[model samples]
Target chain A: MNAQFRRRIASAALIIGFFVAWELLCLAFNVKDIVLPRPSQIIVTLIERIPAIWPHAVQTLYTTLVGFALGIAFGVLIGVVIGSSRLAYDVAYPLLVGFSSIPKVAVVPIFVLWFGAGTVPAVLTAMILCIFPIVVNVATGLATTEPELEDVMRALKASKLDILLNVGLPRTMPYFFASLKVAVTQAFVGTVIAETVASNRGIGNLMMIASSSFDVPLVFAGLLILAALGVALYVIFSFIEMRVTGWARRKDEFALG
Target chain B: MLAPPSAPPHAETYVALERVTHTYGRDDRQVKALDETNLKIDKGDFIALVGPSGCGKSTILKLVTGLLTASSGYVFVAGREVGAEPVRVGIAFQNPTLLPWLTLRDNVMLPLKIVPPFRQEYHAKRRTEFRDRVDALLDQVGLGGFGSKYPWQLSGGMMQRASLCRALVHEPQLLMLDEPFGALDQFTREELWAIMQELWIAHRPTVLLVTHDLKEAAYLANRICVMQARPGRIIDDTIVLFPRPRTIAISFDPRFVALTQRLRELIVVASPPKDSNP
Candidate 1:
C-alpha cells in the first residue's frame, strides 16, 4: 500500500488498541459500573440505546446547522464591508473585536430570556459562538492582499470592483475554509451549552438527565455519540476544503510534508 | 559636454514628461520625490533608466502610466495627456506576481477579460481565439505544455518567463519593466534579456525599463538615461551605437565596455551619501 493508505491503517490500529487496553484494564481491576465504566460498557450502552439517542442527536444537529448557516451568510456580508475599505475597516473592526470578546456562553442566558428556552436560544447561541471566526478570517484575507499584486492589476486599468471580483474574493477562499473548521466545532459547543442550561431535548440534555439519575454508562455513551458526530462533520468539511482550495494546498504541500 | 542637436525633428515624442515635479506627503512632512524631471521618448524607443535606490526612476514610470499624477507639469503618452483613462500600457515587476489560484493560461488572459473591447465580448466569438493566442504566447516563452500547470509547480526562472508573457499578452503599446529579471541568477537573467530583446524587436513597442544593473541597461536599451539621487532628475542620456540583433559576444566590444563603465561612474556619483553637501 501507499504511504497515505498505510497512515490510515496505522491510525485505525492505534484507536482500536487504546480501546482494547482500556477494556482489559477495567476487567482486570473489576472496576465498579457507577465509579468507572469500561470501553466495552460504553459501547454496549451506545448500541442498545442508539434508538433512544437518535432524536436528541438530530435536534442538536438541526440547531447547530441552522445557526451555522445564518452565521456564515451574515458573517461574509459584514466581513466584505469591513475588509473593502480602510475607513470601514477602521470603524467596524474595533467594534467587532469588542463585541466578539464577550463570551458566547454568557450570551446563552440572554438568548434564553428573549427566545423562551427552546431551539431558538440554542441556535442564537451557536450563531454568536461561530460568527466571529468567519468575520475575522474573511476580513484578514482581504486586508492582507499584497499591495504589489494590486499594483499589477491596477496597471491594466482594472477598477477597484474588478480587482475585488477577480483577486480579492478568490484569495479569501482558503481563509474562509480555515475559519469554517474552527467555527463548526464552536457551533457544537454553543448548541450543547444552550441545551444543558434549559432545553428538555438534545444530547446535552440527555447527558444531563443521565448524570442526574446516576446512569454513568449512559452519560458516557451520550458523550461518545456527540464526539463521533463532531468528527464526522469535521471530516466532511475537510474533504470539501481540499477540493475547493486545492491550489492553496499545493503551495504548502512541499513545505509541510 | 558637446552641444546636442535640437529636439528629434518635429518633436517626434511618443511619451514626454515636461518639467514634471512630484512630491509625497502633506504639509510640513512633504518630501520631494522628483523635481522638475524632463524626458522625451520617441515612438518604439527602448530606454533604460539607471540610478541609485530611491532616486524616483519608478516615479517616472508611474507618471507616464497615469498611476500617479505629477504635482506640477504635463505627462503625455501617445500624444494625449494621461488621466483617469488607462492608456495601452503593460508592466512586469521583479517578482512574477502571478495569481496562484489561476492556471498560467488563465493568468495571461486576465486583461482580455477585464479590458474594453475585449472585455465586452470576451466570451462571445473570440474566447477560443484568445485562449489559443495565450497558449501560443506561453509556448513561445518555453512553457509549451505547461499552460495547464499552476504557478507554484514551476521553477523561479519559469515563473518569471510566464510573468513576461502575462504582461505582453494584452498587446500593449507601451511596455514598462521594473527590474523584471533582477531576482534571477546570472545565467537566467541573461537568457531573459535575450528573450526580452527578441520580443521587442518583433513588435517594436515603446519600452521604458528601470534597472540598477548598468550592464543590463546598456545591453538592452537604445538610449540609457542616468538619474540623480533624491529630488530625482536625469543627468545623462546617451545613445547606444551598436547594431540590432545584438549577440552575447557583443559585451566584449570596446564601446560596450566603455558605455557600461561610464554609466556606472555616473550612478556612483549620483548615489546619496550621508554627508553630501546640501
Candidate 2:
C-alpha cells in the first residue's frame, strides 16, 4: 500500500512539473497573453467566467451524451443486421464507407439548416461522427465467432436465434465496449465542432466568443473544461468496460501474469 | 386399420450413410472429400475413425451430425432422413469451445436451453433437475465444485472435461467427437480415455470418434474404420475384440501393441508412399 501511494505521488509530481515548465516557458518568452496564456492565468479566468461558461458547458454535455447514445443504438442495430446477412453487408457497406468519408464537421451547416440552431444540430453532428466505430466493431465481432463453437451449436440442433443470443452476443461484448470508448471521444469532438459553427450555447460557442474578443485565457479555460469532460466520460466508460468484461480480465491475468 | 407390423426399432439401423459424396470448390478444380461412402451405425455402437491427415475423417463426423449436407446421397439418423430437422446429437471438438462468458454449469446447460422438449420445459419444472444433472455429470468427469468457475479459469484438460460434460448433459442418443483429446498431453489424453470409457459404459450413446492416434483407436473403440487419403474411402474396417471396461493399462498388453501396430501399418499403406532412405 505504501509503495502504491508513493507511485501515485510520483505521477502527480510529474504532471505538476509539466505544468510549471509550460507556465515558465510562456513567461520567459514574454509571449502576449492573447497568444498563449499561462496556466495560472487560465485557472483565474476559469473562476472569473464560471457563471458565463456554466450553461454552455452543460449544453455541450447534453448534446454529446444524447448524440453518443443515439449513435450507439442505431449503429449496433444496423451493424448486427448487416453482420448477420451477407447480402445486407454487400449492399450497405459501400454506402456506409462513402458516407463516413465525408468530413462530419462540413455537415454542420446542413444540419443547422435542417434542424435549426440549438441542441439538435450539435447532437446530429455527434451522431454522424460517432456511429461508424460502433457499426464496424460490432459487425466484425459478430462475423468472427468461432466456427468450432458454431458447429457444436449446430450439432446440438440449436436455432439461429439461440446461437446468436448465447454465443454471438457474449463474445462480441468486448469488441462493443472497446469501440464505444472510441465513439464517445468522437462524440465530444462532434459536439464541439458543431457548437463552434452554429450555436449561442455550448463550450465551443464560448471558445468562439472568447477568440473573437482575444480573451485568450478564457478560451484556454473553455478548452480545459472540455478536456476534463472528455477525460471524465472516458474514465466512466472504461469502468463500465471493466465490469462487462471482467471474465476476460481474469482470464488474461491467469494466462499472462 | 394399421399396416403390417413394422420391424422392431432395436433391429433397425440407427444411423446410415448411402453413396454419400462431398466435393469441395467448383467444377474442374473440385476436390472430392468423400466418394461413394457407405456405413451403418447401430444404436449403441462405439466406433472410431482412423486415417492419415486430409482423409476426410472429420468430414464424416460433420456429415452424420448434419452440419454439412452430402453432395449426392442420403444420410439418416434415428430412422429419419437428414435435413434441417433437429436430431438428438451431441458433439465435442478438438478445442473445448466452451462459451467464455458463461460459468461451467451454464455452458453445460446450453444444449438443454436450446434443444426443444427440454427447451420448452427448461424454464419451468426441470430447472433444479437440470442443474443437478449438470452437477452430476461434472462430478462424473471429476469436475465437481468447478461448475461455478468460468471456462478460462480451467486448465486445458479441465476445460476438455467440462466440454465432455457439456456434450453429455443433454443425454443425446448420438455423440460425435472430432479429435477431442488430440490437443492434450499424452498423460491427460490417456486419463480422459478411461473417463470416457466409464461414461460410455454407464450411458451407452452411439459414438463416432475421428482420431489420428492408433493407440487411441485401439483402446477405446469396438470397431475402427480406416480411410485412405484425399478422395477418402474406407480401406480397412477392423474390429477390436478388447473386453469392456478397458483401462489405460491395456496399452501395455501385447495384444494392444499388435492392434496398434496393425493400424499404423494400414495408415502408412493407405498414405501416399513416402520415399524415405535409411
Candidate 3:
C-alpha cells in the first residue's frame, strides 16, 4: 500500500482502538451512565435521537455558517482598509486590538439587550472574533509586498489602485486563507456560545437541556455532532486553500514516502 | 584626461540628466546620493553605469524612470521633463521579481494590462493578440513552452530569463536594468549577457544598465560611465568601440581587456578603503 493510504489506515485504527478501550474500561468499572457514558452508549443515543435532533443540528450549522460568512466579509473589508493606508492602520489598529481583546462571550449579553436573544448576537460575535486575525494578516501581506515589485509597477505608470489590484490583493491570498482557518473555528465558538445562553434552538441549546435532565449520553452526542461539523467545515476550507494558494506552498513540505 | 563632449540638447537625445542631484531623507538625516550628475544617452545607445556600492548608479536610474524626482536640476526623457507623470520604461532587477502566483505568460503580459495605449485595448477582445506577443517574447528567451508554469517552478536562471521577457514585452522605449544578473553564478551570468546582447540588438531601446562587474559592462554596453561614491557623480565616460554581434570570444580581445582594466582602475581609485583586519 502507498504510505498515504497506510497513514490513513493507522489513523482510523487509532480512533477505533480508543473507543474500544473506552467501552471496556466503563464495563469493567460497572460505571453509571450518568457519571460518564460509554462511547457505544453515546453512539446509540446519537442514532436513536437523530430524528428528533436533526432540526437542532441544522439550526446550529445554519447559524455558524451565516456568522462565518459575515465574519469573512467584514474581516476582509477591514483588512483591506488597514493594509492599504498608513493613516487608517495607525488610527484603527489600537481600537481594533482593544475591541478584539474584550472576551466575545462577554458581548453576547449586550447583543441580546440590543437585538434580543437570537441569531444576530451569534453572527456579530463570530464576525468580531474573525476580524482581528484577518485584518492583521492581510495588512501584513500588503505591507510586506516587495518595494522592487512596486517600483516595477510604478515604471509602467500604473496607478495606486492598479498596483493594489494587480499586486497587493493577489499576494495577500495565502495570508487571507491562513486567517480563514483560524476564523472558521472561532466562528463556531461564537455561535455555540450565543445558542447556549440565548437561543431556543440549535445543538448548544439541546446540550444545555439534555444536561439539565441528566441525559449525559445525549449531551455527549450533541458535543459529538458539533465536533464533526467543525471538522467538516475545517476540511472543506483546507481543500479550497490548497486550490487557491498552492503556489505559495513548497512542494517538499509534504515529503512522499 | 580628455574632456567629455558636451551634449547640446539635440533632438536625438532620448534621455538627458542636466546637472541632476538627488538626496535621500530630509534635514539632518539627509544624505546626498547623486551630486550634479550629468548624462546624455542617445535614442538607441546602450550605456552601463559601473561603480562600487552606494555610488548612485541605481539612484540615477530611479530618477530617469521618474520613480524618484531629482532634488535639483532637470531630468528629461524623450525631450520632456520627468516627474509630475510616470515615464513608460521597462525595468528588470537582480532578484527576477516575478509575481509568484502568476504563470510566466501572465507575468510577461502584466505591463500591457496596466500600461497606457495597450491597456486601453487590453480588455477589448485584443487579449489573444497580447497573448501572442507574450508567447513570442517567451520563445525568444527560450521559455517557449514554460509560459504556463509558475515562477517558483522554474530554476533561477530560467526565472531571470522570464524577467527579461517581462521587461521587454511591452516594447518600451527605455529599458532600465539594475544588476539583472547580479544574483546568478558565473556560467549563468555569461549566458544571460549573450541573451541580453541579442535582445538589445533586436530592438534597440535607449538602455541604462547598472552593474558592478566591469567585464559585464564592457561586454553589453556601447559606452560605460564610471561613478564615484559619497555624493555620487560620474568620474569617467569611456566609449566601447566593439562591433555588433560581439561574442564571448571577443571578451578575450586585448582592446576589451584594456577597456575593463581602465574602468576598474577608475573605480578602485575612487572607492573608499575597506575596514582593516587587526
lDDT of 1 by residue, A56-164 (tens): 9999999999989988998898888888887888889889999999977888888878889889999988888899999999988998888778888878888989989
DockQ of each: 0.53, 0.63, 0.65
Worst 10 residues of 2 chain A by lDDT: A248-257
lDDT, candidate 2, residue B210?
95
True contacts kept of each: 0.69, 0.81, 0.89
- For every candidate, how close is chain A to the native chain A in TM-score? 0.91, 0.91, 0.92
* DockQ of candidate 2 relative to the true structure: 0.63
Report how far residue A179 has shifted in candidate 1, in Å: 1.2
| Candidate 1 chain A lowest-lDDT run of ten | A248-257
Question: Which runs in model 3 stand beyond 4 Å of their true positions?
Answer: A250-257, B1-11, B84-86, B124-127, B274-278
RMSD of each: 3.6, 4.8, 3.4
B215, model 2: CA deviation in Å? 1.4
lDDT of 2 at B256: 87
Residues A29-56, candidate 2: write the lDDT tens digits: 9988889999999999999889998998
* Sliding window of 10 residues with minimal summed lDDT for model 2 chain B: B1-10
Per-residue lDDT for B1-278 in model 1, tens only?
A: 22232224454678999999999999999878899988999888889999988889999998887779899999888788985345667889899999988888888888888777678878873458898998998888888988878888889999999999988888888899999999999999988888898889887788999999887887798888999977788999998767766777778888889889999888888888852445
